[model samples]
Target: MAKVNKRLAVLVGCNYPNTQYELHGCINDVVAMKDLLVKRFGFDPTNIELLTDASAVTGEGSSSVVLPTGENIKAALSKMVSQAEAGDVLYFHYSGHGTRIPKPAHIFGHDEAIVPCDFNLITDVDFRQLVNQLPKGASFTILSDSCHSGGLIDKEKEQIGPSTYRAASSLSYKAKNIPFESILEHLTTLTGINTSDIGTHLLESFGANASLKFLTPQLESELFDFLKADEGILLSGCQADETSADMNPMESGGKAYGSFSNAVQ
Candidate 1:
């Protein structure tokens, strides 16, 4: 008998449509990965949940398209983890914008995050928490196809350079990250709230859409416990200081896609 497919996945693709932070290929990346998982990995169709922006005009995930909001993404991951047993395989693939934050208290000396469509910052702390909840012998692999994706799992060992987000020494592509301050500025323009405190403004504008990591800092001990979970694996697109390029239609044979995500596919 064929082995049962003991796999689950939460795929997220945020293009931030009609906004200044618009991306061209994130959704394409997600769709391609879904296809790869279904055909090659044989993950049950019912076991794969998709979250994307605007339901994807391509109609790939239109049947049950969940928006890539911060809460929805977190909840989906929670649900996947809750259903997993020992030795099961879990995967999270994020194709969107990513930004870095200055958090001296974090084990990494900073925080890396993927930018949900709503701009709620899901930090490394949150990913660590997710991994910690996984049952022993389970594996949660994360492929982040966005800028500053390095260190997304808090204490994961580094395999690349430019330890923090900064100007890449030399890159020819545009980074899918808005400076953290610029995100605040954008919110200010729309919400008419001007403050250096990102958590405050995000709470005001996006409300519950904002990430809890910004609102409530997890205790150091709790964070330590989260990091101690060794089942998490990270496939970051680039070093924190470097940018990941999203190929536009012109560059990708008339189909837009994230460069890193395409390579993985």
Candidate 2:
């Protein structure tokens, strides 16, 4: 008989303050996952961690922590990777909004980003970079309940502000101010439909990296190889163009599971 291994789970959900933009219902998903893992998978509660917006203020659970900003997220991920041990299973869940930024000169060489919150956004390259850093021989599974989260797409044209216009124009002349609505329309035309391909592509790219090593036979070659290169599994909530819905109405106080969460439960 094959040996059974211990697992570590990290659950996260975010609802940005002052905005109803976060419709993914990540908190409920995390909670549901926590219950399912305990009830069905027989995972110890002590092995799991949860991070969320409210938790940032309340400071709950041993494994559960809160991320107040983008910097906090970076630090948390770094800590999580550092804490991982070989031969252990790691489950990570993230539910929130994804945004695109103007690609920088480094990786992918195009402007794209995933909207994280008010102050932070995660680019495709940035996310791939993080995934590449995971330890070997560990089973890492990730569920991202968000959209348009795929690979780098040019967002330079989508940027607005006097400084951007001036930089692009090279001070040729003070042109009449352009409307943001017009720019958005232009961006839509240029990018067509922004899909979740960016996220999948990033995962694929990471999985393709040559340095990955796999330790389990049950793991399929393609999926394993891809993840070894990238080192994780991401079960996204929907396709690139689709939006993940909140099962509960905003006014309701009772917690509810998202479609993916409900299915998992």
Which number leads on TM-score? 1
lDDT of 2 by residue, 44-122 (tens): 8777666666543212333344553444555555566666666767776666655433222356333333343433444
Q: Which ten residues in a row have the lowest lDDT in candidate 2?
A: 169-178
- TM-score of every candidate relative to the true structure: 0.86, 0.57
Over 56-156, each residue of candidate 1 has an lDDT whose tens digit, in order, gives: 64324344468888888999998999988888999999999999876644665557888888777788878877888888888999999999898788777
| C-alpha lDDT of candidate 2 relative to the true structure | 0.48
Record all residue pairs in model 1 with backbone atoms less than 3 Å apart, i.e. clashing: none
C-alpha lDDT score of every prediction, in listed order: 0.80, 0.48
Which candidate number would show the highest lDDT if scored against the true structure?
1
Q: How close is candidate 1 to the true structure, as a TM-score?
A: 0.86
